[model samples]
Target: MKLNQFLRTALVACAAVFTIGVSLSTQAPTVSASSATYKTVATTSIKKAPYHKKSSAGAIYNASHTKKVANLKTYPYTTWYATAKVTLKHGSSKALYYKVKNASGSVSGIVWNKYVTPGKSPFGLKYAKSAVALDVNTNNNVWTKNPNTARPIASLSKLMTLYLVRQKIAQGKGTWSSKVNTSNAGLKRLGKSNVFGGFKFNHNSYTVRQLYLAGLIESSNNAAIALGQWVAGGSTPAYNKKFIGMMNNQASEWHLKHSSFVSASGMEQNSLQPYGYSIGASKNANYVSASDIAQISRHFIVDYNDILTDASVKSMKVDGQTLHNYNNLLPGRKYYQKSLKVDGLKTGYTDPAGYCFVGTGRKSGHDRIVTVVLHDENEFTETRSLMNYVYNQNLA
Candidate 1:
């Protein structure tokens, strides 16, 4: 079958199938978005449908449980998108199929797949699975899956820690030159065999600025604990509690419902090993959505850049061992040399969380864009691909 012809037939077939199940209100779920209307079909049949790629832009889709499923008791009348829109070729056609299963044992809804033509914005393509893209310059938000779904933030939690520290510094309670000692207990807690295994610090003495540099630049866990301890008077737990409170306070102040924090370090409990310690467990760590990340980035870019100054940003060295900034895309060509206005940002990863980044960059005099990728498998490739898509297609 010709691609376009096949797509038309598939769309018609899906529509017919969805129409039959529309009256099965208890079984056939209805999903409504500002941009489109969706009807649910059988959940088991989604994997059987074939999908054709119509564009070079990336796409993602996942069959995970909808966030609504968890809150059905509270929001009984809610709707869910069974199949999200993927980009298509102009004047060409493609179709994908999806099944939407309810919390109960039965199939509740089916998604009649439709394809969207690529937009003018290069970065406007749909990401497969649960993904979202935003252009702060135009207030343009595009998402597949639940864009506002809150998930563990991993090391991205450090941005908030840095923010609070900066706040204290601004209030004259602290300064960049302020020195803080690292305790044996703090070192022991941070010395767990993970990212911090390479650091060989004295564990007895370090300045606030020194620890801050290590925490933000190299993402040293000990540095993070040390800074938190210093802030809360040599108690990591107390400091962590206050730090989380600060995060909640910021969330409330910013009207962010999907933001929460439980630890300064994003560690959580390990499910695989009942006794194993997991760094940034899904249950006990910080959580935030893509939009929340954008909001926080805006605060950093527009409001708090002064705090993360070039001097302080560059001042990250541990015991005279200078740590190279992991933000490889920052204003240098070693990673993506030449004409890239990429500046400082944070990167995070964990087994449960996958790879995540909250990156910011600019193109000449064009609008500054913040690109965030969460729960990505190959974060480096994904980040470069997204950035290339934005620079070549969207921002250019």
Candidate 2:
């Protein structure tokens, strides 16, 4: 018989046993009606002799082997086959139908379907009231809370400073190897109470690339002031104009309207007054939204990979110290998995800005996620929590 027909018959027999319990009267159905086609022949069965005989070779001889020929009758044993037909319903129509049965008639070894539910985010940051996440590769927005609200970006604005430097480099206005002389005025500006303490001396001579690296990976205000002065032709007004222009240009390109840039460094001189100190400004600081920072990060990953790939940006060593990328996620830690494929990014912190980070990582085959946290009280904990949440929800 064909395989399908055999399975159908077996399923029917098994279904009968399952529905009404197995019985001897439920014999397997015959497919053919003609007795000649399914003929039974007479056969003889041999009987065994009595035990307790040994061979000449010293091996014991069994009863059947030593028994004499004798006439015997043969009979076929009874067997039952049952098959079951199952129908799966979808709405008002039957979706799928199949037959199943027990091969041994015991129904104990039969296989069945197993169901499982999908997993959710594991980091447990879903309760956060304000969070923004975007996948740069897919441009998918995954936000748990308020994502568009304006917030201080802190040193994250240095990304724009680096962007402006790259812009100048692309325009042939500046070269990576170009040397920048730090003056007394520039050092004083960067050494202000609100600025970096590293910028104390006027004799510090660094290349454009080194300054950019310091500003980007180390958040060095001195380097930012130097670059800003270089871009402004050693004039504060000139540099501020170009800085704001570049910021607006980037904002427009990235479709970020809620963000603005007022300084190369993001430091607000003081909160009590409208005017604050920046790289060159003695006024209020720059501001940007979390979304804009994410967009800028995407641009760096896509359009400006060369900036990060440059030898100067990669292996920048100055003052007997080698500068590394500020992104802590590049080298995966014990608490963070290396499988997340996280690369270089930026981090920011200020009294007014709190702690902020723009992190990016690729997942699966096509999923690439970017997370931005702004004005976080506990940045270390919140950053890890948000990163874990996005990785689990979007990548895992």
Give the per-residue lDDT of model 2 (tens digit) for 14-72: 11111123221222112223211211121222231111111111111112112112110
Tens-place lDDT digits, model 1, residues 1-396: 000000111211111222332123212222323213332323332222223223322122233212122211211112223333322111122233343322221223323233212222222223312344456567455333355878776777777677666667778888888877755554654555554433445656776777776767766665665566566555445555565666678778888788887656555444212212233434565678867776776676666765335422533456767665656555442344344466657777666666677666666645666667677654444455455445443333
RMSD of each: 16.3, 22.6
Q: After aligning candidate 1 to the native by TM-score, how far in Å is the CA of 159 from where it should be?
A: 0.6
Which ten contiguous residues of candidate 2 have the minimum total lDDT?
Answer: 1-10
Off by over 4 Å in 1: 1-145, 192-201, 233-236, 269-282, 306-316, 331-337, 388-396
Whole-model lDDT values for every prediction: 0.50, 0.50
Best by lDDT: 1
Question: Over all chains combined, what TM-score does candidate 1 have?
Answer: 0.60
